[model samples]
Target: MQGDVGFAQQILSLNLVPRKRLSSCGNDTSLCDFSEMWYGVILWTAVSSLIFHLPAALLALFTLRRHKVARFMPIAILLMGIIGPLTGGVLTSAAIAGVYKAAGKTMISLEALVFGVGQSFCIFVISFLRILATL
Candidate 1:
């Protein structure tokens, strides 16, 4: 979770255009401001989701070399890897929000939550594939 929080902070610091220019065009009845922020956010979520699970995926791949250890450990590791990040993201977001509140800032950081949910989606898809593989 800490790692994920750090990663999010790094991304935030990049000052990406979409994120940096949120809802800039204010209340023009005729003009439509369809910002591509959603696209950037989606891209970020997808990439980060894969990256967050890369370690577990690598470990699972390596464990495949051993017969006995390979049987269940890989799947368990993958599942736990997915779950740990989700919980970590939630807790980290909350902690950061608390800190901001204490500092008299009204900002609420949801990057951790977004990253966690994105990774959770990846895990669900993988688990579904595994189920299909068994059948």
Candidate 2:
């Protein structure tokens, strides 16, 4: 019985001992594979962007037709429709791509980069027009 207790204690101690100097290398098996996660995040982002922007686009169109707030109302509506969706899509894509890079993945896909750039450009143009409208 004493020998059995000692063996149990030894096993418990071994299990409880903290591991030191965890490896920083990519070989760690515990880390989640982010590839699928990235794809899901990007897809959801695109879908949500479309859903959110659809209603906003409709509202902008209605406002442009009814209120006649400014001569550049068409431009504003276009910006809201195109730029808003593009911005949201790109931001989400970039975030996923960034995670891919952080995970020591060697290949960064071009699709995400293109999406991000297109979205950023749309945002820039939208902001410019908004400023112009204000002026």
Candidate 3:
């Protein structure tokens, strides 16, 4: 049973790997290149998670400590991370809408910016969640 669980975890980890193929950078290369590529990828994932996401998650968790369930912290971080940008954009837009309205120039609407950011943010957060699940 334990072995089965380990196998399932391994499968999940393998599935989480990006499907994009990377060509070898050198001629006459062997497993070393392939191994190195995956090593670099894993290292990059860890480094990015630590550098970009961890602090945000920590801040979200800290803020949520007052009014949230512990398990909801991760979801809260994802939501807060997204909402923070969107809210800022909305506030800025409300401030600038009049200027744009008067200028009659081409500029993205605040709703468009918020929606675009939200869609991209969801993809990013899902990928991070997958990475965490593997770990």
Candidate 4:
């Protein structure tokens, strides 16, 4: 049972690591290259989440008057702000890890987790501010 749980965690970890892409210098031959690539992964996910959340927030604001769940908008948005980054993290990480794995390389999960949390925090701050401004 413990082994099964560990295996599941390992699978999740694999998906949480970032994908492989050309570093800022267009090469993946050094640790610096990998770091730069990871930064890009983080930035891409962060920006994507921001783009999605902003429009969603605006739409919710406009529809609040007619929606039955008007009162729940704040709570819902708050929840999604938390969940969105996590979902994005898993997806981006899995995609990147898949690429790296296909090329016979490994990414450190700890770095993934740290960057994911940082990304989530950044998204949360920007989203909160944008929503507050809209309201």
lDDT of 4 by residue, 16-84 (tens): 324365543323322233443355456445545656566666677777857786956855764575477
- Order the candidate numbers by TM-score, best to worst: 4, 1, 2, 3
Which lDDT tens digits does candidate 3 get at residues 21-120? 5523322121123233333233333333334555777776777667746746767666654564355434433444444445643232223234334444
Q: Per the 3 Å backbone cut-off, how many clashing residue pairs does candidate 1 have?
A: 0
By summed lDDT, which 10 consecutive residues of candidate 1 come out lowest?
27-36
Quickly count the clashes in candidate 3: 0
Backbone clash numbers for all candidates listed: 0, 0, 0, 1
A best-first ranking of the candidates according to their lDDT comes to 4, 2, 1, 3
| Candidate 4 lDDT score at position 67 | 71
Off by over 4 Å in 3: 1-32, 68-135
Return the lDDT, model 1, position 71.
59
Q: How much is 90 displaced in model 3, in angstroms?
A: 37
**What is the TM-score of candidate 2?**
0.34
Cα lDDT tens digits, model 1, 17-112, are 344333334421111122222333334444455565677667777867567756566566666655554555445434544554466433212443
* Candidate No. with top TM-score: 4
Where model 4 places Cα greater than 4 Å from the true spot, the runs are 1-32, 65-69, 78-82, 87-91, 94-135
Each model's lDDT comes to: 0.48, 0.49, 0.44, 0.55
Give the local distance difference test score of model 3: 0.44
